[model samples]
Target: MRPQLLALLARAPAYGYELKQGLEQTFGPAYPQPNIGQIYVTLGRLEKGGLIRGQEVAQDGRPDKKVYEITEEGIQELAEWFAAPTEGPRVRDEFFMKLVLAPGTELADQLTLINNQRRHCLTMMRGLNRLAAEEQGNRVSQLLIEGAVLHLQADLDWLERCQEELT
Candidate 1:
């Protein structure tokens, strides 16, 4: 959220509400919406960190609003974020741990766990498909949904492998 806010600030100066609106407009339903309070908290942190500068602007009839603009340090940070490669999911995931440990304790059958996970992944893929349809015009949303669906498919494939090996 910090980086995203900085990216928006890098574009132009905006108040907290305006930044929230920009995020909603840009990500649509693809990303979780950050609440106004969260935005302000983040803005305060960013200002304290010297990544952004805020100016209080007087309004005609309402309270003054603080508009935020990204600083040079913020731009450099954003650039580094853009250049960095994102890490993949770790091997020691919750499901994998459960698959390994649950059977020894007789808590749950491995086959049952794999089947349940497969069903859940299928259900999620269906929902993502519906969301993709709704956000057909939003390329960013479509891409996000597509990525999620692919990850789910990969999970399903891994479940198949687990069943083959354990069951």
Candidate 2:
């Protein structure tokens, strides 16, 4: 959230409400709606950390508003965030742990667990397909949905491998 706000500020100076609106407009339905309170809190933290400087601008008839601009430090941090490669999903995930540990315990069988997970993944893919169709004109939303569908496909494939090897 901090980095996102910094990136937005790097583009132009904006107040808290404007930042919230910008995120929604930019990401569309692909990104979750940010909490306004959370945004203000993050802005305060950034100001204290010297990543941003806020200026109080008096309005004509309303209360004063604070507009925030990115500091040089904020720009550097945003650059680092852009350059860093994100880590892939973990291999030892919840399903894998359950599959490996279930046999020794009183939990359900490994094959049953794999089948259940596969069903869930397919259901999710179906829902994503519907969302993708609805968001066809929105490239960002479409891309995000496509990525989720692909990940679900990979999980289904892995489940197949588990079924063959374990059962």
Candidate 3:
């Protein structure tokens, strides 16, 4: 969220509301809507960190609004963030933990747990596939769905390996 907001501010100085709208427009529905208070809090932090500076502007009929602009430090931070690779998906999911630990626990059969989780993954994949097909024009959404499908496929494969090992 910090880097994203910095990137937006790097483009132009904008008030908190404008930045919020910019995020919605840029990410579409893929990004969840952030609370206004959250935006203000983030802005405050950025200002305190010297990554951004906020200027209070007096309005004619309303309260003064603080507009934020990215600083050189923010741009450098954004560049460093862009260069860093994102961490891979978690291998030790909660479901996997429960499956491995359920043998001696009061939980039901481990195989049944694996099967139920596999079914849920398949269901999610089907829904994502449907969304991808329906949103052919929305490239961003399609890409996100495709990524989800790939992850689900990997999870299904991992479940098979778990079953083989546990049984």
Candidate 4:
């Protein structure tokens, strides 16, 4: 359950807030960012599981911080999790479902949803592009940023096509 959080921490020892921010920044705003409480609780759980260990770091003018590092077992578990091909039922796309159910749904309503999604995606894409460009020496980072932009562009194009078909 907290495997992802644990895996992320395993990559490098990080303070709870630092880990949370890094995940949020990586995944973007569409994904729910785990709160500090959840991070601490999960640290406790992972400590109990023996997958990870944390130490309280004393800081001046700040709350004592728990820094987490993945254990050998944790590294093995994380590697196995990464290597295994994930299997699950296909996730339902609610937008498509809405169109199916409401055959007579107003074009305006569908367009509204598409446009809203597009706006959010565009903003995120621009921000990611800027961040990646600032660190342009990293080919992997550049690829990730451009890949996200391309996917969002495809979605926007599909939305346009859907609008034309509906009209």
Q: Output the number of the TM-score-best candidate.
A: 1
lDDT of 2 at 80: 97
- If both were scored by lDDT, which would come out higher, candidate 3 or candidate 4? 3
lDDT of 1 by residue, 1-167 (tens): 99999999999999999999999888778788989999999999999999999999999999999989999999999999889998878777899998989877877999899999999999999999988889989888888889999999999999999999988
Q: Positional deviation of 167 in candidate 1, in angstroms?
A: 1.2
> What's each prediction's clash count?
0, 0, 0, 0
Per-residue CA lDDT of candidate 2, range 19-94, in tens? 9999887766667777999999999999999999999999999999999999999999999999999997896699
lDDT of 3 by residue, 70-104 (tens): 99999999999999999887877799788878887
Q: How close is candidate 2 to the true structure, as a TM-score?
A: 0.89
Give the number of the best model, judged by lDDT. 1
lDDT of 1: 0.92
> TM-scores of the models, in the given order?
0.95, 0.89, 0.84, 0.60
Identify the runs in model 1 with alpha carbons over 4 angstroms from their true place: none
Error of 3 at 130 (Å): 5.5
lDDT, residue 138, candidate 4? 58
